[model samples]
Target: MRYRALLAFLAAIVAGLMVVSLLVGPAGVGPVAGIAALVDGKGALGLVMREIRLPRALLGAMVGGALGVSGAAMQGFLRNPLAEPGLIGISSSSALGAVIALQSGFAAVSVLALPGAALAGAVVAVALILMLAGPRGPSLTLILAGVAISALAGSFTSLVLNLSPNPFAVTEIVFWMLGSLSDRSMQHVAMAAPFMAVGALLLAPLGRGLDALTLGEDAAEAMGVRLTRLRLMLVLGTAALVGSAVAVAGAIGFVGLVVPHILRPFVGARPSRLLAASALGGAAMLLSADIAVRIIAPERDLKLGVLTAIIGAPFFLHLIWRTRGQIA
Candidate 1:
């Protein structure tokens, strides 16, 4: 009952935020007219609501939900509360791929080049992680390998930016690395939606496996929770989710890391329940953050990633302080 109530509450918050998100843009559409325009699809108001704010709101929700769920799944699989989607290097690698595409001038040829390169980078990163950590390796091993991969990927991304001939391209790298949802179109929604949907399908059913794994690997295996399959699903699903998200919005941080941490206590720390909760919470947090960026700096182009980092980094320090004993 509590779980249901919590989920319902989060859902309500997300819904409210989505409505606000759609209505809060510079178009000056009221709640009633904005919603009406969404369905009516006739006038300039309709076009702005449907085309501009709608895609931004939808992508914000999707990206936030993906990051949140992926973070929960990662934490559950590793049995570490600190585990997040980026901990596996997938986000960095995807960013690297997008950076490369942007730098190489291929992105000019096709709209698909950026995201395609990002997805490819995610795949390669996953392959490398699996190779370095081994299929059956422990969580610490995976984390260490992921850190190395993330560092390497970050370096390559920096190199790409440094080597770009277009001075403007160097400036664009901040948007790619920090993430933003500005000027996003329905085409981006179309490109990323399928991958995000598929990844959600893969991750949603793993609650039982994560719960079992909480009892330890041997216990989980004895209980018939195929560790190999679970691991594969986690890697691939996270890759798909994070890859698609970074491809579309760049590398918005903290939603994945912070949302789960905030919602975990409410869900009794069950990975599966936490997944759903985090999804909603993440959506709310990001929508709120997006709204904040626009409100706080309507004139300056504030990066979504920058705002999240400001909020998350302090929280991260607090988290570390709380867990210092464990780390030591």
Candidate 2:
């Protein structure tokens, strides 16, 4: 009963924020006006509501939920409090693919080029991780493999930036790295949603396996849990969610790390309960941040990723501070 109530409350927060996100844009449309325009879809205001604000709001919720759930799943699978989605290198690799597309001028050829390249990169990274980790390798092996992939991808991205000759391309790449939802279309929402939905399906059922894992591997296996399959699903699902999100939003940081951490206690530290709650909390956090960026600097083009980093970095430091004793 208590858990159900908590889910309801979080869902309510997400819903409220979604509405606020649609209404609170640069156009300054009121609640009633935004709703009417959204429904009517006839005039300029209607176009703005349908084409611009709607997708932005939808992506905000979707991206946030993806990152949040991915983070929670990673932490649960690894049995580590600090685990996050990006630790597996999917986000960086996706960024690398996008960078390659932009640098090579492929992104200009088609609307799907950017995200397609990003997803391809994520797939390569995951394949490499799996190969390096091996099917029966321990959690430590997976961590090391992911770290290696992340460093390699980061270096490659930097190399692309350093060698690029076009000043315009460089500038565009830099801004894209910072991330934003401005100027996003429904096409982007469509591109990312199916992957996120599939990823969610892959992950949502892992609750029981993850809960069994809390008792340790041998015990979990004894209880009919298949550790090998669990690991594979976790990697693929995380890749799908984080890959699709980064493909659309660029490299928004700390969402996966922060949301799950904040909501863990509320869910009694159970991976099963944490997944859903974290998803809701994440959506609220991102939507609120998106709205805040517009309000705080309406004149300036504030990047969503930059704002999240600013908010997340301090919290990350605080987390480290609190866990210092444990680290030592």
Q: Highest lDDT: which candidate?
A: 2
For 165-220, candidate 1 gives per-residue lDDT tens digits of 88888877766678898888888899999999999999999999999988999999
lDDT of each: 0.88, 0.92
C-alpha positional error of residue 227 in candidate 2 after TM-score superposition, expressed in Å: 0.4
For model 1, the superposed segments whose C-alpha errors exceed 4 Å read: 318-328
All candidates: TM-score: 0.94, 0.97
In candidate 2, which residue ranges exceed 4 Å CA deviation? 319-328
List per-candidate RMSD values in Å. 1.9, 1.5
Worst 10-residue lDDT window for candidate 1 reads: 25-34
